[model samples]
Target: MPASAPEAPAPALPRPLIGWRLLALFYDLWPALALWMLASLCFTLGYTIAGHHDPHENIAPLSVLQWALWATCWLLAGLYAVISWRRGGQTLGMRPWRLRVVGADGRPPSWQALCARYAVGTLSLLAAGLGFWWAWIDRDRLAWHDRASGTRMVRNPKP
Candidate 1:
């Protein structure tokens, strides 16, 4: 009888390039924007119902209420990110590009890690994306969040 042929090993998964990461972030911004708008609408309605003189007046800039609105938006965005990462390791935006967040061992990360990732990612954005840009110089091509959270984003192989 002829010997059976040896099976080939699977190919190594490659890390996603910065361009892909940026594209996913850009896609995610749309959903985040929509959520922020909804939150703003609710805040505006509450402000008007509180007996403000003008029904159509905008929330006063730098007021306590305004600060609350900003905080709500930030929390909401963080929830969106943490939940997505926890549930499936991929957000809506990451789905299209096949990007997934995994721990150093390549398994789903912990909730704490996911939150850390979101927090660091927020700082990265606030710093003009310098954290994201760090991947360019990183030997492992990891972003700031990746390093801080001990998580990494990797591209899945095509099915």
Candidate 2:
């Protein structure tokens, strides 16, 4: 019988370390901030159009409109994250860092999983980043959102 060539081994997954993840998060903040500002602007415009004609008047802090603005900003940021993750696994911030989100099975995660990730990540931040710190102690180096959503961040090899 003729000898055949050996099959190639599968490429290893490039798991990103916590430091890299943190850097990416920081980078991502710029875009998120922009989104928040945009949301705030729209809310302000609406308030103005609603006959709040005083030049110096603004949306009162702790008012329902202000709360709604906060919620809108949050949703906008979530949409930015989830849409980026779903479409390409990498957000603008993640691109420079070469970080990409992948499912546990090494594929694009479902919408539900992505949403869960965003929600948990928000909670993590609200908790003073304790969830992110969890990675340092986690056996697999996965954060709470990662474990909760069955998704992970992988560092892409340099070109």
Q: Which candidate achieves the best lDDT against the true structure? A: 1
Alpha-carbon RMSD, candidate 1: 3.0
In order of appearance, the predictions have TM-scores of 0.91, 0.92
Which digits, one per residue and each the tens of the lDDT, describe model 1 over residues 8-99? 98665799999999999999999989999999999888888888748766767799999999999999988998999899999999999999
| Clashing pairs in model 1, backbone N/Cα/C closer than 3 A | none
Candidate 2 per-residue lDDT over residues 1-159, each given as its tens digit: 999999898796777888988988998899999989888887788788788755368777799988898889899999999999999999988998899999998989999999999999999999999999999999888999999999998889989
Cand. 2 TM to true fold: 0.92
- How many Å off is the CA of 154 in candidate 1? 0.4
